[model samples]
Target chain A: MRKLINQKEHFIKDMLDGLKFHDQKISIIEDSIVVRKVKKESGVAIVSGGGSGHEPAHAGYVADGMLDAAVCGEVFTSPTPDKILAAIKAVDNGDGVLLVVKNYAGDVLNFDMAKELAEAEGHNVATVIVRDDIAIDNAEQRRGVAGTVLVHKYAGYLSGHGSNLQQIVEKVENMMESLHSIGMAVHPCLVPTTGEFGFDLEEDEMEIGIGIHGEKGIYREKSETVDKIAGRLLSELLPHNDDNDIILMINGMGGTPDSELLIVTKYVMEALEEKGKTVHKLLVGNYMTALDMQGFSLTIVSHNDELLKSLNAPTESTHY
Target chain B: MRKLINQKEHFIKDMLDGLKFHDQKISIIEDSIVVRKVKKESGVAIVSGGGSGHEPAHAGYVADGMLDAAVCGEVFTSPTPDKILAAIKAVDNGDGVLLVVKNYAGDVLNFDMAKELAEAEGHNVATVIVRDDIAIDNAEQRRGVAGTVLVHKYAGYLSGHGSNLQQIVEKVENMMESLHSIGMAVHPCLVPTTGEFGFDLEEDEMEIGIGIHGEKGIYREKSETVDKIAGRLLSELLPHNDDNDIILMINGMGGTPDSELLIVTKYVMEALEEKGKTVHKLLVGNYMTALDMQGFSLTIVSHNDELLKSLNAPTESTHY
Candidate 1:
């Protein structure tokens, strides 16, 4: 694919510059180099950071009603502990700070070390590891996916309202238990520098439960109608859907058009309706996306009206 | 090439259903079949709409602080007069409504008729036809591209503040003349059901001044580095640059990533800096994307600090 880039290595820094250019409140620390734009007044600041390819996930959620600081790593790479620690310090408002992390081993370890460093500085710190993906053999060790967005929204609401570190951790932990996510890919994504397709899939086939970092999936099958796809995926997600309401997310991997995403959401809603499940809140867009990958994912968060109300609260950002 | 639809013919309606489902206040008028969401407020309301497939373009922008109502047509097809009329009526709040139309023959004619109908209904109405694209053979009849977004921002800003009909019309008309845009595409986009690419280019080629509606472009050349690509495109756009300050938009056609967009913007900024031009405000993203086509366009609106302030105004929407 043709791309408008100066050098592959400079892509992330240039992107960060443009992001900061568009929103001047966003400042990159010269030493640690975390991309943070908004500041919290007096609360337990919430910080989440990860790779760069997912454009709107961590940083885009940094605004008044969402995350306060987002430290970005290289494309699909975890940030160093120093960068994470810097973000924690930047957003710390004397109350405490919460680190929201995905379940990838690198991300978990890095944020954990950063948490220790923050505590060593005499600042109270806690962490919530979101392991919401259900596409793996070990549900306990499943890597986090787009469901992290819901965690960010809820945690931001709590932090914005001045929740203590313990309260924030407990709330996010509750949300983590209620969310399950799964994804599928049509064509693999190509890394910018190497131009290597992250994973392989046949032209007429799709791989379900694929990792955003180009990891292999659990199943490969011929592509079907979106309704069939939704059924197969949600079956694994909603095993006990008899009584819970859900906040449904139909997210593009990156390159999937909004038309296709809406189509997929159509089936997802139908599947929910068929199971007599209530969809209290729904978001369909490229919330967390891969780099030009042709696929999408479904995230179902079982929640009550309170979580739904919190998710619907308004915020300002370039991408919502 | 894979899709989620059961059949091609139902794609638009299904997507509309998904949009309405997530947005409860939004509904389709059965008689006119215009899709719009009502803002439960007593203030003056603004309505805008256009062709579909530019996902998050018109519809995603129709939430708080932007547009009160957005009417969508079929993929790349203009809405009928009745549809536009319905949208105006749906959002009218006695303070009059403004119609923001991209400069295209069909969009102009249809929205004009809608304005007449709205006026006939005792609802004050104003229209601003955006002719901002610099790629046209004739500047007077230039086609509007993504720079209409600036118009949307300013007009929405004024309308949100309850500006009178005469005030809104004058401001939008004055603003339209100062906006100039130009775009290119690496490949043609497929209409959802057809699954066929609109136009084809060699692996190393691009088409400049490509229309958002798939109109033929002015130039086709071998694709080059981001700097060289920016050089060629800026050359075509600079002759019309005639403002002391300007707002710049480096917009993705849909499929391009932020990594590539910043690279494109780097050269674009360099070219502007060489002329000693000042870009007071900049927006870079998929503002008015053309499906999943892998390409981008540049837009600059010559304006004073007032317009710059309005452009920087906070907006709440799915995509900003």
Candidate 2:
């Protein structure tokens, strides 16, 4: 695939620079490549980072009423601890900082190291590892996916409202207890540098519970109707939801239109209603999108009224 | 080409149903297929309508601080006069109503007929046709594209602030006089029922000035760098202006990433800045997108401080 990139290695940096071009309210730290709140931010700062292919996932959500800082790695790869550490320090206020880390192994280790580094510098820090995907064979071993967007939103609410690092971490952990996400892939997206798909699937089939980084999904099947897809996704998530109120997310893999995402949400709502569950909060869009993949995911999180209200809080971001 | 459509004939209705499923405030008229204001619009209600493929074009812009109603038709086809008239009536208050129509042969004719119908009924009405596309051969006969979004935004601001129909029409006409848009397509999009691409281009080439309905562009050549693409698009538009302040819009054609769109916007900014023109506003996203087509369009609209300030006003809509 022909792309408009300067150099394969510089793609991520250039993309980040482009993001900062129009919105002067956002500034990226030179050399370190970390984005921080340009406006004065008080209280605990929430810092999140991940691979860069998901355009609005980690960075676009970093605006007022959301994240304080965001770090980006190369597409589908975790950022080094140094990058994470730089982001943590840039946004660290007197109240300390909280790191919202996803559950991918590379992401977990790197963020954990950064947390230790921040602590060594006398900065009070806490980490919340979001493990929301439910597609793996061992549920305990599944990795994080689209649920990370919710973690950022929920964590941002706590941190933005003056919660300390520890308090914010506790809130995120409580939310994670009932959060589950599952995604499917219609086709593999080509990495710009390689000009080859990250994975491969037949034209008539799709992969379910696929990882964002082109990791193999747990199941492969022929492409089905939106209602059936929603049924399967909800079936996997609703079983463990002990809370009566659920926060549901219908996310696209970047390529689907909002119209289709809403159709997925329609089926999801019907699925929940048939199960006699109350959906307290709902979001359907390309939040936490994969790269040009045509499919949708479902994320269900058990939440209290406070969490529900926080999830729906107003946020100013480029893509939100 | 795998789409989320239920049936070829029911695509528009089903898509609108999906949209209403997400936003409860949107109500679709059954017979007319017109989406109108859920809350009573006290001021002169602003109504807009156009082809259907551009998801969130008209309907997505209708909300608390935006358009009062939007009428829909088949993909890339203008709505019937009956549908447009129904939309105007559904949103019309005692004050009056202003119809914002794009400058296409079909859209202009249909909306004009609707305006006449509404006027014959003794309801105050006015119409403003936006002709902003600069990619066509002759300036006098160019079609409308992304610049229509700016018209909708400004018209929404005026009508929402209680401007009369004549006042709103004057404002819209003035805005249209200073607007120009140009677009390119990397690949052709498929129409659902026929399952055929709207146009054809070589794998290593792109078409400039591609119409919104998958019509042929004026120029076809080997794909160039995004910077060059932006340069070419702005080159055509900048001549129409005598170096005035303008708002810049880099809009995705449904399938491009926000990251890539930002890159395209970067080039557009550089091109405009090189000409010593000031950009008072910048918007980058998938506004007025084709159906999953891989490309983007740039729109420049000259504006005064009033329009600039109004552009930044808080808007609550699904696709703002």
Candidate 3:
């Protein structure tokens, strides 16, 4: 209700307009689609999108070394098949196009429909569903969260380097197997359309495994200390063995301040050190965020040297 | 307080430890100081600092082409003269050192004392105080706010390009003159030491012209629409003539989400367009912040070709 929007109907479009105004490297296609300004290179073009509320995810990563285009939908809603097809067509080079779909039902269905439509028109398109959220028991039903950004980075990097579609797909699949993410929220975010929070949480309670869409978590309990919360989240993320180094992401679920994020990072790092696990690389920021959820998520991806190199690769993207 | 902190006493130091752990380019000197990991170049070394709550300002800006060192104090408290002197000594190359001080009584006094101490030890040092907040009347007493970051970018770029202390000082002074900033807060931020908000506001009320340290604003009124707020802010920022291009910064005061910032930016851009003013560059993020204040600040700096080029210059800092 306190959001700074002109009209609830134009929230996503207006945000895209503002994004295009600020960043010259990105352009809007057919109002709902965001594509890189530069012409697509002859390689596997990377495209991804879901809802609009999780910013700096799809659009902010649209650059030469990252996503080629991002099909933006309304807040917490999936884009239509036509919009996804348009983004695919806009960024499709001769090689192919890859759609990195999150494992939400609506996103999966719409992106799949778009892939079918694009492939029907003789464009080679591949799809990869990222289900990195460890909060749920069923792997097929797991929701993709902040770990999707890491998937974008690797897929975009490999594709931009002229990797064949199969190679990119294989690498992404391998990366997905090692990735895991889980989030907790102290407050639920409001849906711009309805101007109401998706759910209510008592002031003293916190959701332990909330989804980015304000989805119900595994449990709600009395709010605990940050150190205990970090331990709980890391227990879900860290792999059992210490054979491989990990890349950790301490992501703010949009309303959390950077100061709190750093404090959380301190505890997460300390917890990892205590467990005798080495963090090869640490990323701390709002890479993917719920609109105004006052929470944070911990994402840990087991990484080898090649994956580390891909992540550290230079990117012209403003937010990667 | 629903903050992610360990102990109030160790919050700043622990955050710095996490920063140094994540960013290999920065290191901690003494106990509360952050310096670039690389050796200082033989040119004017830029040093700036105040409180520790403003993440990614003083410390995150310490890199090869930005501040050589940042003297970090406790949360919302200015660094002591001894700490500033330690920072000055650590990053002082043979050429000289330049201290970029914000126009706060505590920061100004401590930095001045550090300058005297450094000069007594036979080091060439110059200081530039940034006072760009348009909320206050007297230019001499105006508090420096988010506009101080722009001063850092210009000053660091010039000093890194091998400008002498005096040349860097002159450019920063000129840059400061053209800079203006104003902030509004929906709620006051809490001080960790006291675990209480600096001020209280009713549910429907907002504070205009709020200071970074939770200082009382010029007025308190019922919260207005974003368009009205943007119009009022621009009325104070834009110059009388419409012939100049300006760089704009939409800074989140810690707790404001990026989505709201973009919406606020949409209206600010529309207002500028209506007034026939051109925005040449836009930097939108949490450049400077109060701890967990749900508000934002707008900063505009009139710039020409040289200043724009300097602002766009490359820097190794993680958050510019």
Candidate 4:
């Protein structure tokens, strides 16, 4: 795919610079990490980061009621430990900072190192891993996907309301248990660094249970209509949806057209409703993306009153 | 170019169903028109719509202080006069209604017919065409593109604040005079209805000044770096800047990844700043799109206090 980037090395920096211009409140520290310009000194600061291709995931969510800082790395690559440390330092207030790390080998290892580094610097930091992608049958290895946004907002709302780092961490940990996501891609995205497609598929095929970094799905199948695809994802999401009132997000994998996203949304909502699921809230858009992959993901989490309230809380986060 | 949709005939209806689910305030009337559920009883109402593929264009912009209703049509096809009439009658209050039509033959013809039909019912109504696209050398044939959202917001802001229909129309018409936009597509989008691409392009070629409905641009050229593209667009937008303060929008043509968009956004902002123009406000995202076209467009308008205030006004509009 033809990319709008200057060079592989400069991609993240240029994108962050552009992002800073898009939202004046966002500031770049050490030429990489994105931190909020005005952070509260009396509250727990929320931070999240991982591979950079997920557009609004970590960076764009840095706002008044979302993330305090986002450590963006190169496209589809985890941030370095030092950059993560810089984000931790930049957003750290006296109350402490909470790091929301997605489930990935590199991200987990780097963020863990950053946490210890921050602790060595006399700063209190709490860390929680978002293993929300349920595409894998082995739950322990599920990669974090769009469901991580809920973790940010839920944690941000709690922290903004004076919850300390420990309290925010505990609540988010609980919320993470209910969060689940599954994705299928009609087309794979090109990784800018390698100048190669994430995966290949026939014109009449699609991959299900795909990851945000273009990790191939567990299996491939002939491409089906949206209704069938939505049903396939739905069946894998929950146990037949028995009276589950959930906050559902129909996340577009960057390149999926909005019309198709909505069409998938209509079918998903209808299917959920038919199966006796009460959709407490519905979010449909490219909340988190896989570069410009043409597909959609379903992020479903059973909603409680607090979760619903937090999800509905006003956010200055660019994509929410 | 695989799409996540059912049959073509059910595309718009299914999409609207999903959109209504996305925002509870949005109500689907006649299974085609999208109107706000809770409308004020005493204020001028604003409405805008065209073909259905532009996901958040007219429909998503319907909210408090944005649009009262969005008359959606089929994919890349104008709505029948009756559907437009339904939107006009559905949103009209005793105060009056304003029709914000884009510059397209079918849209203008149908909207004009709808206005006349509404007027014959003794309801006060006015109309304004947004010919913001600067791609066409001839001003008379310019197609309204991403910049129409500005017209919607400005007029919606005015109407919601109790501006009479005539007052709102006059102000918007004045604002329209300064609004300009141009777009380029690195790749053409697939038209679902026709089962074809919007336009044809080679691997190294791109179409400049393309319309939202897949209309080819005025010229084609070998693709350049985003900085060059931004510069190319900037030069064609305004007359060497002249230290003008303006509101700028970097709109994605659906399929462009967010990373590329921010890169584009960064260059555009840098270019404008270097040209000595003050950017009062900058919107960067897929506000209006041509299906899943892989490129972007820039919309610029010199801003005064009211226009800035109107642009910066808080909106419940979905994609703002």
Candidate 5:
């Protein structure tokens, strides 16, 4: 209820306007889509879309080495198929376009519909569904969380290097196989439309395996020490094989302080060391966030030499 | 009470360990201070520090183009004179060293003591105290908040370009004079040592002109819309001049989501336009933040062509 917004209905549009104003490289298309102002070299365009609350996920990644266009919907709601089609048409070059869809029911359906529409218009398009959350039982039905940012980075780097559509798709699919993530929330975020939290819990309790949209977690328990929490998350993320290198990402779920995130990272690193897993690369910040959710997520991607190079490739995005 | 720290006493050190682990470009000095791994050219070394709660401010900004070393203290506590002296000695490369201290009583006293100690050791050192908060009436005694980040960016860029100590000191002083900032908070942040909030507020009320360390604001009033809040903040920042070019920075105070910050930026841009002030550059993020406080701060620096170019200069720091 203490959010800084004009009207609940206009939150997404107003935020996009502010984003375009702050960064001149970004432009607004049809008032619901964000695209880079300057076009990159002719290559496969990387397009992604979802609800509006997970900021710096789609729009903040629109740059020369990142996303070409980002289609945004209202708070915690999927974008319409027409909006997705518009974004695809705006950024697609002769090379083709690829849509990075998270494994959510609404998001998968809408992006698929948009791909069909774009194909009818003589534009080649492909879809890659990311379902990297390890908390769920079924991998196919798992929800994509903060690990999606890593996929975006790999695909964007490959596309910027003039890779064809099939090459980029193959890299993304390989990334999806190795990436894993799990989240725990101490507090539920409020939806702007209703001005109320999606769920409630006691002050001393936390929910494990919570989704980004305030979905119910697998279970709830009393809050424990940071090291214990990190152990729980890492147990689910780290593979059983020993002596593997990883790219570690510690993502703050919007309301957690940076200091606390670093504390969590300390324990996570300690846990990884004990398990004989070496972290080749590390990223710690609010890359993909649930609005005002007080928690954090740990993402681990088993990295080889080629994937590590792709991860280290430079991009001009504001928040990659 | 829901913080992710292991022990309150080890919060600062653990966080620094995590930071060094996350970014290979940063390293720890004397087990308490943070310094960039790569050495800069022979020039004035820029150093800044205060409490440890303000992440990405003093330590996260330590890189080739930013601070050479940052001395960190416990949560909400200033570093001792001995710790500051050690940092001064660690990064001093004969050209001289500049200390950027905020306008808090403890920080000023300790940094001044350290400067005398460094001088006695045959090392030349100078200090610049930043007091840019426009919320209070006594300009000389105003608390240095988020606006100090701008001073750091300017001084660091100049120092990295082989500027002498005098030149960097002059640039930072000019930035301090032209910069002004004001903040508001919806919820008070907790201190790790005490495990209690610094203040309290009702759900329907907000504190205007709040300080970064949970200090009381000028007045408390009912929560209003984003436009009204933006208007109040801008009225205090803008001078009486008809037209002027300024650089606007909308900084989140730790807990506010990026989505909400963008919404706040939209209204702030509108308010500046109404006042006939043109914003040349805009930086929006959590540059300097309190520990889990739900609010934001607005900083305005009246800039000319020279300062604009300096602001846009690239830096190797991870946060800036």
Candidate 6:
């Protein structure tokens, strides 16, 4: 579980420096926030962030038709209110700023505080808390996971299309209701900051419904075939609605090989098609990942004309 | 090291089935060949393939502006000539077909044999071998690696622009001469077929210049800083010619996190700029990988007007 990084204290600073080269349109500000180099003149800027281990999640989504900026925190840790404030200030044009916060207590509190701070300075700001994880029984307690990427796109599409901040927030709130996601891990990821695995699994055991920050899963079972695993995730994530059309995302945690991700994609799609559901769009790869965790997460969003258009829209963000 | 696969024999089949969902334009035929769903009416079609472990290489390059088809082999093994012939027959649209092959002995032998068979069947065909690795002093012995993707894009750009088969070959042959690449690994990957680590490393050491198939590198040393590692690869790969403008690719070998790759990209760009070289184009991410090997490769190509135009052309491939 050794990492190819310099000092732990400088891990993120060096990473921020590295990220500046990702796109000519993306640049680093305040040594932690990643913002678009060209801020569009007349649209609500969309901003999001959380812990750092989920590579390409918040930062990778920063682009022209995606996020306007991303506030990068420490590994498995939330960014401070000041850093979040900096990102809000950097990308906000004359229109307004929208904060998409994943549903973690640390994130919810900090992002909300930043929204308050910005609004206090006479800048227009709004917040949307994404809690799409369905692993837990209580909806309020479910942590946000890979499904947040969709929220980013949906909001970004609306903003880029010249929708007002209120209109975009209302549409995003509706979309969040139809989004659900769950992930399973064969091996726990090592948290670089802690120098420890988030959890341990036996040789033949796997944790189902784990968190991106390596939170312990709901339960453990012997590792199963790819078909059964995909089936299990689909069973838990398939929406109860009557809409058969849906968008499917098969995301690979960092260390999982693309071969394995491809296998997972086959089984998941087959299961959906067999169940008589139409896969409106399928995105498969490492979009959002737990660091080096050998796992895959299935994210399902009820397909609509707007969501499909949003998903199909071109994005300058490298990973999306 | 456990793989999330059903059976070793079914590995490539399941992966191929799964890859169909990557893009509507990509499809699978003959169970092992991936080709575009809509073949263009004119111009030469480009094809390439090697072993199966390097995901998104040959297959990921199959799109409107890239490869017309890719032959899938077993893990770390060459595709049979029969598979290659099937791909050639599937993609030829009377403009002739060009086969872009990596320079592994098995791949060169099989791809060349397929060209002969295709030509005997009265379908015009030609082959161009890519051996861009600069690890070994003897150019004949170097392995074709991440740099092959550049060749794919270059050749595909030519074909889509209505270049004839001979013109495409002439340009590709000249372009291959300017391509050079090198890679380093922190941890070896697991061979799904053999259920063994491709190679081994100690707690504080890394392998330099390893092959995509996990062939041992030219040497190993104590793990060095990312700056030093990037510098060493650049020292070996920089061309003697005075073309300061160049195209650079920072590729991840499967398991390394995007954060580290970004960090690696920063140092590489800095090192290149410090040398007064201008990076006309820069690509960074997991373009080629060795199963789940934790490493990175740097590919450098002397920049020219045509190469820059080719690199900037759009493609529908998911990973590129």
**Strongest candidate by DockQ:** 5
Q: Cα deviation of B207 in candidate 6 (Å)?
A: 0.2
lDDT tens digits by residue: candidate 4, B268-311: 88888888889998988898998888999999888799989988
Residue A236, model 6, lDDT: 82
Assign candidate 4 its CAPRI class: medium
* lDDT, residue A133, candidate 2: 82
How far off is residue A242 in model 6, in Å?
5.1
Tell me model 4's lDDT, rounded to 2 decimals: 0.87
Which candidate do you rate higher for TM-score, 1 or 6?
A: 6
Model 3 residue runs over 4 Å out of place are: A239-242, B239-243
Error of 1 at A23 (Å): 1.6
lDDT by residue (tens digit), candidate 4, A27-75: 8988778888886677998889888999977789999999998998877
Give the per-residue lDDT of model 5 (tens digit) for A158-185: 8877689998898789777878888988
Candidate 4 segments exceeding 4 Å error: A240-243, B240-243
lDDT of 4 at B206: 77
Worst 10 residues of 2 chain B by lDDT: B31-40
Candidate 3 residue lDDT tens string, A1-320: 45566678888877888787778888898888989888775889999999889988778888878898899888888999999999888888779999999999899999999899999999999999999888898888999999999999999889867689999999899888888899998767766679788788886688988999888888788878778988888776665324457898888888777777887888889888888788898999888999878889988888698789889999987776
Q: What C-alpha lDDT do the candidate models reach, one value each? A: 0.77, 0.77, 0.84, 0.87, 0.86, 0.87
Q: Relative to the unseen true structure, what is the C-alpha lDDT of residue A160 in candidate 4, on a scale of 0 to 100?
A: 76
Error of 2 at A149 (Å): 1.2
Question: How accurate locally is residue A88 in candidate 4, as Cα lDDT from 0 to 100?
Answer: 82
TM-score of each: 0.89, 0.95, 0.96, 0.97, 0.97, 0.97
Candidate 6 stretches with Cα past 4 Å from truth are A239-242, B239-242
For candidate 3, the TM-score is 0.96
Selected candidate, larger TM-score, 1 vs 4: 4
Error of 4 at B45 (Å): 1.7
The CA lDDT at A251 in model 4 is: 93
TM-score of the B chain in each candidate versus the native B chain? 0.92, 0.95, 0.97, 0.98, 0.97, 0.97
Docking class of 6: medium
- lDDT tens digits, residue span B115-231, model 5: 999999999999999887777889889999998888888887787676799988887787677788899987778777788987898877889999888887887998888889898
DockQ-better candidate, 2 vs 6: 6
DockQ of every candidate structure: 0.51, 0.51, 0.58, 0.76, 0.77, 0.66
DockQ of 4: 0.76
The alpha-carbon deviation from the true structure for residue B207 of candidate 2, after best TM-score superposition, in angstroms, is 1.4
